[model samples]
Target chain A: MAEVKKMATRDAYGQALAELGEEHENLVVFEADLAAATKTGVFRKKFPERHFECGIAEGNMMAVAAGASTMGLVPFASSFAMFAAGRAFEQVRNSIGYPHMNVKIGATHGGISVGEDGASHQCCEDFALMRSIPGMVVLCPSDAVEARAAVRAAYEYVGPVYLRFGRLAIPVFHDEGMSFEIGKGETLAEGDDVAIIATGLMVYEALQAAEQLKAGGINARVINMCTIKPLDTELVLKAARECGKIVTAEEHSIIGGLGEAVCAAVAESGIPCKVKRVGVNDEFGHSGPAVPLLKQFGLSAENIAEKAKVLVK
Target chain B: MTYEENMDLQRKAVKVRMGIIEGTHAAKAGHPGGSLSAADMLTYLYFKELNVDPKDPKNPDRDRFVLSKGHTAPGLYAALALRGFFSWEDLKTLRQIGSHLQGHPNMNLTPGVDMSTGSLGQGVSAAAGMALAAKHMGNECRVYTLLGDGEIEEGQVWEAFMLAANYKLDNFVAIIDKNGLQIDGPTAEVMDSGDIAAKLRAFGFEVEEINGHDFDAIEAAFNKAKETKGKPFGIVMHTVKGLGVSYMENSVDWHGKAPNDAEYETAMNELNAKLAKLEAM
Candidate 1:
């Protein structure tokens, strides 16, 4: 972990939501028995009337969230990522995405976290699943500060937005003065040899890899790509065109994540650069500590640095 | 609205059935059973009860309606077309490519549609949102929605029911087209929605039982809904599958199957007689 303040991204979501509730009285919230996990329990303590609990039914929770949002209430629904995006995918698309309601879906327990709770709880495909829906704004913040900013951004944005929060308490990445935008990302460390673009918790790993690369005489630029749906296309194109080589990383599947997004942009723009993707391989996660599970899936900082080195080569 | 005027509206429901059949017969495919069951309640609301402006479909002050059971778009399309919200000629374009009348009610694609609801169990949820919006905006306008008896089997619909109860969304009214049949067979055989009124009551809604085809009963129920002091309302309208047609009535096969040419002719003749009677008024 870097020298930064300690905070859980979920807590950031909760704190930011409470502040939004004060600003926009129309902001409502629902949790599928996961208020504590996603940290919306904080909001519930403030405004009991605006908080709804739909039990363990993710499909039901999604529909309720859509209903609430449609009624002019900006609802932020939270649940385990697996349940929110994986199980109730149709509900998310049909109920919330179809009408293009201003609902914010904050999913927690993403990647191989929720460690001992096993693979059924962890979601490595939420970003891909949510991004597939048209008009949906998908986001994965790097740390607590960015997570808070992401919530505020989604609240102000006038469409369905999805926020994927990892279970573990990651270190703070961006500073307070760091500007936040929905589709535009921040360049954490500037490098000229290659750009390592990443989203979610993996942004920290990307930063770490960039630091190591900087020490190894390899100039690597690290980007914190918070938005996944309306991806930072200009940034991606520039990274591919300017840097000439790109390495993408995320705590998700290699097939349909930040890698796929960057690759799509590079392919469409006819940019000639060696593009390498660092993420979970074609294998299911196991019940263990988050770090070991991430290591098993080859999503550690060292792995990202290795891939970045290969891309630069 | 008088007793006589309400009776005349019931006659218009017969016309609604006629329009639904015409649209479906032209399109060669549509769910007719639920449409038949849904016609009377929809007509009663649109013609007299709902505060909608045909000239301005996007009037913010207007009450909203969402047809959650979208497979039965035939009925809603007819309602919108007949109510002067859109050209009745547009009914001919239902479910056809490049036509605004999609297989489902798409708010973006179709004019006068408040919400695009095709995936069953979602329309009710959207209606809940509409009602909540009315409350949040401090608007007096109400929100109305209709769903199939078969569609209630979906868990999301029940979840919406619970939320309505929790929120005390008295401005919302939901109607269920209880035709007792779905695509596979009778809803009872397809996993039984389990005493719908009881389920809705358990979900904390004020329940109204009415014969969906009876205009007087529907009018009375609508009045009752308006008179409701508080709490969200749900009307479990018991209607026969394919209500108006002779051979189609009570036939589960007519749920989605379109009538053949000969059958269409017979159905048209029956509708023409009904329309002639209504026009005479």
Candidate 2:
């Protein structure tokens, strides 16, 4: 059996994309001067011609990728989340989302965990912008295991997809051979007292929180909600109905993040439940270490456990 | 087929233009002025030059066409309808709620629409993607896109243009409809696009200036485009805003205003005579 190694989801994305490209020759990749940074350099080393370095021009890179998809070749465009979502938003919206191209934007360096590089590089609003785009599928992978699965899943799926990753290395949550399906949520733990829903780097923290709650004799169910756009409403509703209380966590802003998505789903179902959100408040991040930044933004395992305790009570 | 066989295509162009004017007039809301300006180019491509199958709109091997100036979708809808991609009757449904014919081109809803475009700078970028695909696949199929002169002001269009040239997208032909007018006023008065031909040449294109309505000139430009070994080709077609009718030609007021019953009657009268001559010959 392959031992689980802690890795940045961006590394998983790079590894998985290379594997998929070799398996299906139709898969192509373009890096916006972040090949080594995003770790997509792995794919570049294998298929040099297929990998295009657009030289720091994120907008141009996005447009090129969009053009590539129209020719029936699936292009995975990798860049930082802030630039991909902010710099080339109109291109992503008009060319890919509007036309519904099969272009996957694999954005690394998302959320506040883009620590040390500080606030300017961190993108806490990628989900809000991407989820707002019509016909765009948004995926926030929790760990390397899920991130590898997400890249493969996004390639198989059609239309526009934004696969967001972060800078910090996180422990692998799923088994080595676990399967990932787009738009579906995975239930990590089963309980009836409270359900913990989370995505991206926070999902690992969320799982730890569930364990902490269990130690205190309170049952907590954890769900890894990877796809934010199609948003596994069935899974969310089941949590709201069965557990009757919910705690949502993510390394994103409270507004329009995984928390908001779960809220909208729970509200629309008219199934009343005590719901709490653990996320970054309306404040910018400062220079710090990874764990401290997570704690400061209230996206830590301790924060999730506290929120789960409140919601369950 | 010879030139005489392709002459029937001219008739199709007139019918397509008629569809454009009528649809704009019917909706009482569309840019008929620009749509009429690009009628001949659309007709030639859909009828003669481009190898496209209406039945297999998404076939990987088919040539890709993009209307970068998406405001003039009426022109494309008319051409696609005549090419049997959809029904000519569908022209009546333009801009209506639930109609596939949106104000701008939408690839999802409408058949034969290669990319959805409405924002001024977007479609060209999408075409860039299509051409890039042709390069990767080692496919000989070409990519043809049309842009409005007014739309060239958008920064992204230039960004996309540079990519096409930098990549030496020899398989791409970007046709610019220099119709001299746009919404609100004449394009010169609004935002001067100085010397489109020389500008495009500087941007690394095999630039050609032509009378947009001249079929011979259009064909010649396309041939020149085909002959060029490297670098993308750009044709700057000098055209009138409201091209076909006497009253509407070159008039900015007619840019989007649908003709009323009286004006519609006059347009039909002029178009009928033209259609009659085209059908007769």
lDDT (C-alpha) at residue B174 in model 1: 87
Docking class of 2: medium
Taking the tens digit of each residue's C-alpha lDDT, what string does model 2 give over B1-281? 46675578777878888898788888888888888999999999998789899999888788989899998999999999999999999998999999999999998899999888888877787787788779878998999999999999887778777878888999999999999888868788899989889888888999999998878888889999999977999999999878777788989888878888788788878888987997777
Model 2 Cα shift for residue A65 (angstroms): 2.7
**Candidate 1 share of real interface contacts:** 0.50
Instruction: Look at candidate 2 and tell me the lDDT of residue A3.
Output: 61
List TM-scores of chain B, every candidate: 0.95, 0.96
Query: lDDT for model 1, on a 0 to 1 scale?
Result: 0.84
Scoring each candidate complex against the real one, what DockQ results? Answer: 0.53, 0.59
**Distance from true position, residue B14, model 1, in Å?**
2.6
Per-residue CA lDDT of model 1 for B50-91, tens digit only, reads: 898889988878888888898888888888888898888888
lDDT of each: 0.84, 0.87
Residue-level lDDT tens digits of model 1 in A92-141:
99988987878889888888766878878878888889989989999999
